[model samples]
Target: MFLCGSYVPPQYLPWSPGSYLFLLETCLFLLFACTAAGSAGSMPSMNNQLNELRSLAAKAENRRTETGIPRVAMVQGKIPEHMLAAVYDPMINVILQGSKSMTVGDRTLRYDPATYFVMSIDLPAVGSVHPSVSGEPYLAVSLTLDPTVLSTLFADLPKPVGRVEHNLGFSVAPVTTDLMDAWVRMLRLMGDPDAIAALAPVYEREIIFRVLQGPHGWMLREIAAPDTAMARVNMAIQWIRRDFAEPIGVERLAERASMSVSAFHRHFKAVTNLSPLQYQKRVRLLQARTLMVANAKSVMAAAFEVGYESATQFSRDYARVFGLPPAQDAGRILGDTRAIRP
Candidate 1:
């Protein structure tokens, strides 16, 4: 199962004394550089924030709890090469080390510490991580974006002067010092429970504000506004997600979005990078996989549960998405000892 962040295995430990000393030196250098950059009203480079991010992520690794501060998470691990699929929520990730690649539609994006990843809507994608060989694992901090918070903040900001075209809901942008600083403060709160209750929201707001001020800020604005085209597509997406087990027609989905069939098809594909039917098929297969793993349902049962009338067709579609037939995939995920039927 995918943790909200990368899983931290027990073998990873907190930074050593030597590493702490190095981090101290790095912080000192960053302070001087940031001061110089601030005098010119320019943001400091992201290189200034990597060490602190790394140290903070290291400390919080493997220590995440359900009752911990909500909407905040840390991840650290040397993940193996594996294709995993999930519907990504609206969140921001600041990578401190290593790199990860995500495939949305036909596009593939690879990002590292110098960049921040944002998903402004729920999207399904395939992802894999590449870790360094010298024992420096992938590390990152994730903060879930709250639409209520975005709406409140968007109102106070000045309006955009020009029309912004709709793009895919996911983006990677250069990290700025202000955003990094806010993230650092948020991560630090994990160590002090008393301070978290009072301070986490303030810091989280700052992070959201900084993102709103960035290049893809308009996308967040669209997500927050209920009347926008993107928002309408999102409504249709929610409908599909809720009733994925039932057959849905494009005309009905378009009506839900208050758009013509052709327009709805275009916008849906633009936002999600998948056609309406493709999206539903993906949703069904993912749900079927969950049933196999979480409920230990047999391949035929799982297929029928997800609206598939033909077991052979279900197997073909499941294999196309997950790289394994239904039975073998179910056996692997559920750790079943019986021989998997083809």
Candidate 2:
């Protein structure tokens, strides 16, 4: 179990405890279901606000940035396709110009400009980004979730009323005008470094507040309450992620979450879309890919390093997830100058 204040990353997302870094090319949380785009008229001329935000976000690159704002980052231009397939960290992502897609199990969810999503759990997501019609590069901004901060917001707000079943790990909705306006204010601070410390938190609270009024607001509410089913599942995800290379069993993980075996399995699969063993396999596969691509480890070595006993089985799994044999995939990535960068 994690300490009270520690950040629990999504299942299958590998974290470097020392650096508190997510070793992911791009980050996202798994949304349980992809609903149709929200009502178009909810926000009049959303593109007006979206365009302003897009201009501000274009300053970022494919890599994530700290940008002097706490728990916020931006990515623009090309993202390495290989990295998108891995599970992701929890975040609120708003696309500026291009489109993004995340495949969780058999379902694929795509979001265009003027849309945003809140993600909170295991992903095993096959994600990709696409350029907009006018040829703009993929551009987006994200707010890394902080449970402590989220919890602070609950005191003043009325208790949210919703069925437990409705509070999934994540969900997508159209970017409300109020939400976009808050984001615009948040990003505008990039040009005014001296003002970030005082204003960033204010703007962040506004963003969270706006989302809390939306249809999926209960999702965020549940994740921060500490004792909710979603939070328990989050705890279980952290347990698996911390010891992915070591073998784990659903029974043990269930006990850790303080839920019965069947309940834990139901909640875990509801949020992550993968069973306990399958989630572990995803973590192993993603780590092996990184070792092979970034560290130049051999296929067999990478397999064993990530707890795979059989090289052939590792190769087969790698091919299925990445759509190519391990060696070939590694070689292809290494050939690209940008892919080799740490």
Candidate 3:
């Protein structure tokens, strides 16, 4: 009933015009039918792969080490009402269950199991998980990207036909069967310690390769390209992250990136969707929050530690970003955690 590729029957074609037309139509119909069937067949396999990832994530939830696989981490948790801020590194987040939302500047990105998010450069973002109350939890696997590996892969792979000027450092892509299969194998390696040393690198490389062939491959490729504008912007971002507590002048940042101040501003905003000063402010606020949450530092002490000049100003800014005063928000987060615990 269905066929693929070049399949012709001698009985159906006797070198007549009518027979040739009928043969062509039949071949086309069979090709369509075969493609549809193949797609239907692959869906079950994809679902099974996602199930395996979900199982591994659930088992690794309370473990000290997220996963035995090197550079891979499993995250699973219930939804939180408040968004958590962090500087996301270069990594790929593959969702196997539930959903989550990330806010970068004014842009809001929501992704679920059908999509994977990639951070090609370090970025400050607010994220919130959204797991349903039906007992399912939000589960995801994250793989940190190694620039050295990306550089090597870019050199060996074919170059793009043309470059796009406007590229965001972060993107979300639909998960394909090939990508899912590679991720499944990478996760499976955690159970086989003997095979990991020899095979982990291979699987990691395959995963990167699959990403390089994806829609946002250009952004990932630019991460390793030293001469690209996106790379220069990334350098400035790194500088701001390293010295967020210090005052950063736009001119000095531009000089460090070897671009004109105006050009640097334009490119930086294009890539990160934030100006230099705004980016630094976000970094400082996030760092201060970390101090309060982890070290239990007082609000004023955390603010001053992150180089805030006035406690009142810091409180105002923190409230604006986090939706509450620093201490109160931190207390509420801790309280929520305690309430959620069994």
Tens digits of per-residue lDDT, candidate 3, 105-164, equal 889899988689998988889988867446577778888998888899889888878876
For every candidate structure, what is the RMSD over all alpha carbons to the true structure, in angstroms?
Answer: 14.6, 19.7, 4.2
- Per TM-score, the best of the predicted structures is 3
Candidate 2 has its poorest 10 consecutive residues by lDDT at: 27-36
* lDDT for each residue of candidate 2 in 1-342, tens digit (9 for 90 to 100): 232234665773445774343322122221112121245544455777887887887779887766779999998877886677676888899988789998876667899888897786656677889999999898889998777678898666887565465445767898888899999999999999999999999999899888888876788877877788888988988888889989898899999899999999998888777788888998899888888776877888899999989989988998887788888787787784344222
What's the TM-score of each model vs. the native?
0.81, 0.82, 0.89
Q: Whole-model lDDT, candidate 1? A: 0.78
Clashing residue pairs, backbone N/CA/C < 3 A, model 1:
none
lDDT of 3 at 281: 89
Ranking by TM-score: 3, 2, 1
Q: Return the clash pairs for model 3, or none.
A: none
Sort the predicted structures by lDDT, highest score first: 3, 2, 1
**Tens-digit lDDT track for model 1 on 75-194?**
667432222466777899777887878887678888886688998887778777666556577777788888787888888788778756676888899888889889878877767889
Positional deviation of residue 137's Cα in model 2 after best superposition, in angstroms: 1.2
